[model samples]
Target: MPRDAEDRRLEPFEWNSEESVRYEVAIEVIGEGVAHYSALLNAAEAAGDEPEAARLRAEIGACVEERYRLRATDHEGVTQVLHKYRALLRAPGDHDA
Candidate 1:
């Protein structure tokens, strides 16, 4: 199936500056980390391992904390809130204009 405009994960970039590209890459890296740990967290929960799940949740919380340096994330329990964090990637003015 073909994907629509909204299906795109990243916005179009015209390769303006090195700093901007690097900043965007950093955001993507954090996002990938989130995805990775979230999957492991899910697996841990499915296996009925609370200890491992808590560990992964902490890892995820740390990654999320770094991703949003301005705001702290108080992640409570197992949440499927990954989608909500996607907007954080674009909201930060981390790049130099």
Candidate 2:
């Protein structure tokens, strides 16, 4: 029997459980860190504060390292969230995703 188009189109959310929610929160933290780092970099550039910029850059690097360390030990839920966030970040011309 041919499946209904609507039924075929209805896909379950990849992360819909409580654990997934926690993972999502972690991913959001990582994203926020990225945004903060980017803003600091921009501000440093605008103000021509090379030293401050260097400091912020180091902080950003540390945050990234921490994120990866957590990810390495995270459960399946976190891994799923990380995968989705990475895909969105790497997507072209659409940062809102």
Candidate 3:
């Protein structure tokens, strides 16, 4: 929600095009943080600093877990959107699509 950022508003439940895109982007950002933290952890481990590496690894694990949660929430959101737009998603002849 910073002023300098382009996509400042958060709308997890808004199914509209722009809001939906932003919500996905937000999840992506968090997911990317997991990679970033893992990279940092790798660097720490390579330096032979066991204490720092252990701490970073723990934080990286937390970040990875959080990203997993975000991904799961995104999956649920996709299911919700699909259900809400079932009529649109359905085939012309098939009742379930």
lDDT of each: 0.56, 0.63, 0.52
Q: Where does the lowest 10-residue lDDT sum fall in candidate 2?
A: 88-97
Candidate 2 backbone collisions, by pair: none
Best by TM-score: 1
lDDT, candidate 1, 2-92, per-residue tens: 8874445344645446545445555566777677677778888999999989887887888777666521122321112233344433455
What TM-score would each prediction reach against the true structure? 0.55, 0.53, 0.49
Q: Rank the candidates by lDDT, best first.
A: 2, 1, 3
Tell me the spans in candidate 1 whose CA falls farther than 4 Å from its real position.
Answer: 1-16, 70-97
- Model 3 residue runs over 4 Å out of place are 1-14, 71-97
lDDT of 2 by residue, 29-66 (tens): 67765776678688988999998788777767865665
Task: Count backbone clashes in candidate 3.
Answer: 0
Residues 1-97 of candidate 3 have per-residue lDDT tens digits of 3564333433345356755675565555545545555666688778887887777667657645544444333656545434433442243421211
Better of 1 and 2 by TM-score: 1
The deviation in Å at residue 70 for candidate 2 is 1.1
Cα lDDT for residue 52, candidate 3: 71
* Error in Å for residue 35 of model 1: 0.3
Which of the predicted structures, 1 or 3, would earn the higher lDDT when compared with the native?
A: 1
Best by lDDT: 2
